[model samples]
Target chain A: MGKRSARLENEMIEYLPRMRRFARSLSRDAADADDLVQLTVERALTRLDQWQDGTRLDSWMYRIMKNAWIDETRRRQRQGRHLAPPEAGESVGAEDPDFDKRIRAMSVERAMATLPDDQRIAVGLVLVEGLSYKEASNVLDVPMGTLTSRLARGRKALEAQLNPDSVEAGHDD
Target chain B: MMIDDETLIAFLDGELDEAEMERIAVAIDADPALTDRLERLQLSDQAVRETYQPIAEEAVPDHLIAAVRQADRDTAPDSETVLPFQRPTGDRPSRPAWQAYGAIAASLVIGVLIGSRFGLTEPAPLHFEGDRLLAGGVLATALDRQAAGAVGEGDTHVQLSFATDAGGYCRAFQQGGTAGLACREDGRWVVELTAPVPAGSNGPIRTASTALPTILLEAVDARIAGETLDAEAEAAAIENGWSGDPD
Candidate 1:
């Protein structure tokens, strides 16, 4: 490998963890998420020439994964295969001391999975992954305003689901 | 000026200009309700971050690493330039040049159904039980004993082993032009998704390659729970006869 390719490989490996996290949110399943990450890495490496210098490599990868996921979703939809809702509150290891915390986390994940695809990606990128609005917009190929709206709606829905008492008081309105 | 939820969100994200940020900071300081709103939003963001934090800490599976490396190798300039038959030493001897050429040609056409990868000199009969295709003959033997990522003597190759959300162990396998994802359920390897390999596609099924077909990968993904088993776990699963929770 040339110096540039070596550097890119290193950088890609460094981003793998975060990429995996982002993918888990988008894919809502560990295996699928990792597969998405793998596909993203493969696509990025093959199209390294297309990645413009000075732009964020992570954002470029996020775009690739998002697109790959979209394609997968479309294929599944065409096959009439719907995602079965994840089994709720699947135990997170028996030794875990923070059982409540784990349940709450699983709840959030389930709630996030329930969001519409666009809203889920927007909230996941901006709120969870900490991507800036512009970066997320670029990743999703949406305008900034569209990204913000999705984030707002997703966040609202998540908040309602997570904090039902607050929502019962009409806080969602 | 009253801050709207969107403005507060932008403020939280640090997306606003200096003047707007300062104004929101002042407003937040003066207003308890606004402060509560900001805190709630921040808490939600923190929760979301925390929920996904574990995934980052989990070890990346070896197959993904191998795939990336394979892609790197594929992209390297020398990869395309060097042929399997090309040798540095000009000493051409034992076998005829035509034999060497034939070997090279065969390797080039590795995954075609008629090629050696399929291991079919004559048409091999396919056995099926109703609509479910049972892995009989060589394919069954591979599923019964072959370790993942290990090239079996038979045409079938098991690629990955993982635990499905349904509490079963599933394995992805490929044999020449055929590939599928099978899960262990009710004491049998149930084929979840199978299809004939597409023409001109370099998906993992066609070769001992790590690049998985999108459809097969999706099938595996839809079923798997946490990450696929690493090498050690996969070996153990195979030893336990593909039972995820072998008692």
Candidate 2:
């Protein structure tokens, strides 16, 4: 491989874990998420010329993944396939003291899944992936204000579901 | 200066200018209520990060690595000029073109299963007794002996076992290259749905139903009476020969 291609490959490998996590958040099933990540990496590698120098490679990859997920969802819609219901808080950890924590985590994931696709992506980018607001806006191709509003709305929804007492108390102020 | 939640969030994310960040810092130091709000936001951020932190520790599937390697090879300069008769060395033996196409077709079936999250793939070559699909070959043995949480080295592995709402028991199994869910009806394990197992997926049985393929998971969701059986329950069920009528 050329030095440039090798560098790109290394960078993509480094991004794989985060990409898989983002894909899992977007996709309902683990298999589908991995497939989406595969497709995203393949597309990115094949079209590396499109990526601008000096830009964050992770952000560029995030954009590709987001677009690929959108396309896949559209295709599924056109095919009239039944989308899986949101995960219903299936406990992840084996029988242990940490099981409760795992259950809470599952509930959080389920709540995140309930958000609208746009809001979910916004939250995933900003809160989950720790992307800067500007970088998230760039990935979503939205204005900064739009991104912030979406994040606020998504965070509010999450707080309502995950911590109703605190959310209610905050609302009184 | 009164700081709004969005501005506070931006400041937390380091999205604001240095001046704005300093102002927020001073305001936060001066105001107890604002400090509480900022702490809440910070906690929420930490929770979100922690929720997905486990995925980073999960093993990467080898098939994905192979795909990346294949892309690298395809992009190499001499790859285009390689002789047709010359096969690549150090790789597994190449299958016939038809088998390659068959794998692609199976992959597409798996894709459909992933998208719809429920449905059966094309049937493998299993002996059928009338219309009722009886577990044959490795599938039959796995259904007979494998416990829900146990991970067997054989080609057929039973991943989960639980009771259906109909008072019958169902088990999810992966055999050969496909994964599926089967419910016991009239003493026979009837196949619900099967799809090609994606590459590098041979790991321990997943405790999280979320990791399951949508179709298999949907079938489980539709039939499960309550929560899936815990490990102790599953072991007892296995001991009882997976009798749908659990005591």
Candidate 3:
């Protein structure tokens, strides 16, 4: 946390909530999401020097979160902790657990979990997190074109999982 | 233009230009089924966002922040020169990045494994250009030109260099201040590996002043094609006409 990346630091702090949301969506568990967020922050802080001034802060943060999520998942799998849900609650509104919110959130997490790591991350960044194509691209350190393609495919795949009927409907249209 | 998912998504995110968004909006209006499908996409996005929104808003716990800050403090010492391949010693478990790579390899031929990670591969070995060249310049030159015997008790030293069978090269050299290595092929010398060779063992990492480390040497070996060079061989090879690819 050098004082030099002051703007970046401020941006990072401001965006922590969004980053946490993105991480939570990926990890699905409070503890794991927290760990992922911490790792992302640590990495961002350490490598603050690598970030260019012109780039969007959210994209860079997303990339860090995505990488951290991948690493954490790999570590968990290596430790044979795959089956246990990473998060304690099933839904985002787990604290509430009322019917509509609970049902939607649980289904979303379940569908999200079924996705391959890359696809899930792309969807999480672009759709769930509402990152701009350019912003998500910078975070992934992928070319903008690559990010767009990934987002397109990821969303399509997610739709197939969450609402297979929609795919058929999509084809019919 | 035909509607693509990227275009649709850009529309969904409110990122499309007015024309693109308007075009999609017209299409959605024209087809009831398309409107339904787009609505589902939007709802799903809302659902996911709603689910994770709490986590986002919740304050970052002090413990997590504290742990990260501690890791920063712990690693700050070696942040600048932490090589990618050096292993951790018993004394320092929280090794820097390079030492962590080396520590991971300590179980086996850490050196060779470390070499390949930095792209000093067997067939298509990595060559140093701008930053890499500056990063490992003198040490690479010393490794190519000097022999162990010629290494002085002074601040710089040449430890090793060899041309592998595959036509790539690897070297381990040291600034008397820092023990490290440099390897060359096709006129480009990439510092693939480095470590503090003890002055006794060459005064190990603490004594080595140069930035290149032994972990990078492992990277070099992982990619080299044939055996490395001894002093005499390097001299002879340099004297003969040289080209980027080994003949």
Candidate 4:
């Protein structure tokens, strides 16, 4: 109805896809990730003043998403055992299911999930969201050294799993 | 100083000093392996970026815009009135009382509607819990180590155990009373229960009296085969170095 309302609405519209992609990275399931992003949008709108102009909007939204996910995770704990996929009888690997591609994606996702929450947050911000290290540290509320160590270890672990071949494989790849 | 992979990732991420980048460039030039790895890492980063790049290019959804618009409208009035909702003690008690009564009634009705539709009164949190919960410390550590069918002692508690049809072990877990689930992947436990489970279930009876919660039962069903791990079987799984099919 008003100028500020219209501008905020436009900004939210612009953020959907990026928010969805980040949600996807956090949640491997397409549907679940979309739900998470939608929830993020709803919450960010509800708490509009919390967001300051000139701050990284993506990071702020991400903080909301992370908090939402954490809450969801806790709620699910009561009966949330990992469900087994239907017994497809030897579940053929997609016949050219691109096993390597799936493995690569899963490997990276799994390793990233394993990182301590703060480190994972940092990795997502810096490596995934393209936030600078300084920005990530500020977002994560950690000392630069702490953030660096976490990032370094998280990167190394991911490298080891995602590309475990040459001596320098884990180092860079 | 000679650069390592950590330094290389830092460099690629622009965390490195200019001197460090120059040093790594020299080392990369001298070492074919380093150069190849750098190229691959860059390519991987590029690929991840590319995979998500389309999101930035895609059109934003309309509903999200509408929600934000509605929120802004709601806030505008509050912005104008420094204490819009607060009672004016000096006003005619009857007039203020009626307004207060009306607001309270409206809020109560809205709350009830939300509760029923979303199962908000159910045992679990209806929405996000802010920062009070998420995997942390020892819980994070244990999830990293356990794979399907394996259970180990220590910081993490395996509340329930099951085997996947894929022949891997999966466990419904809790850390400091916060529930989660992790399954074995590539000989390591990978967590999959970091999101909320949808409402309703077949309501399976849990053997562990103090089991994490029923929300995690679906996770167990998803991966458990045969009977669940009894105390003895669970102990065996832990004792035998945690090697077995989750099924």
The candidates' DockQ values read 0.20, 0.13, 0.22, 0.14
Ordered from best to worst DockQ, the candidate numbers read: 3, 1, 4, 2
Kindly list the per-residue Cα lDDT of model 3 for residues A40-120, writing each as its tens digit.
878876786677766666677788778777777788789988833645455567777478778777777877776778777
Cα displacement (Å) at residue A5, model 4: 2.6
Model 4 residue runs over 4 Å out of place are A1-4, A78-116, A166-173, B58-62, B71-247
Query: Model 4, A104-165: lDDT tens per residue?
Result: 55545555555565565566667777878787777667788787888776666655555667
Query: Top model by TM-score, which number?
Result: 1
Predicted structure with the largest lDDT when compared to the true one: 1
CA lDDT for candidate 2: 0.65
Q: Which regions in candidate 2 have their CA more than 4 angstroms from the true location?
A: A1-4, A79-84, A87-97, A169-173, B26-33, B75-80, B84-247
> CAPRI verdict on model 1?
incorrect
Residue ranges of candidate 1 with Cα displaced over 4 Å: A1-4, A88-95, A167-173, B80-247
Per-residue lDDT of model 3, residues B1-247, tens digit only: 3576677777887878888788899998998777776776776677767777667667777545443433333344434442322223555432233343233223222232433334333222223355563223233334444454243322234444556666655555543223444445556565544454322221244432222332444454455554445447766655542233342
User: How many clashing pairs per prediction, in order?
Assistant: 0, 3, 58, 31
Candidate with more favorable, higher lDDT: 1 or 4: 1
lDDT of 1 at B164: 74
Give interface RMSD for all predictions.
8.6, 12.1, 11.3, 14.3
Report the lDDT of model 2 for residue A1. 20
Worst 10 residues of 4 chain A by lDDT: A84-93
Model 1, residue B84: C-alpha shift (Å): 4.1
lDDT per model vs. reference: 0.68, 0.65, 0.57, 0.53
**Candidate 4 structure quality by residue, lDDT tens digits, B1-247:** 3566678888788777888778877888898877777776775565445444444555555444444444444444333322222123343121212223233223233333443443333222111235233232233334434432233323233445665677666666632223467666544455565422221121221111122333465455545666565657656765553565332
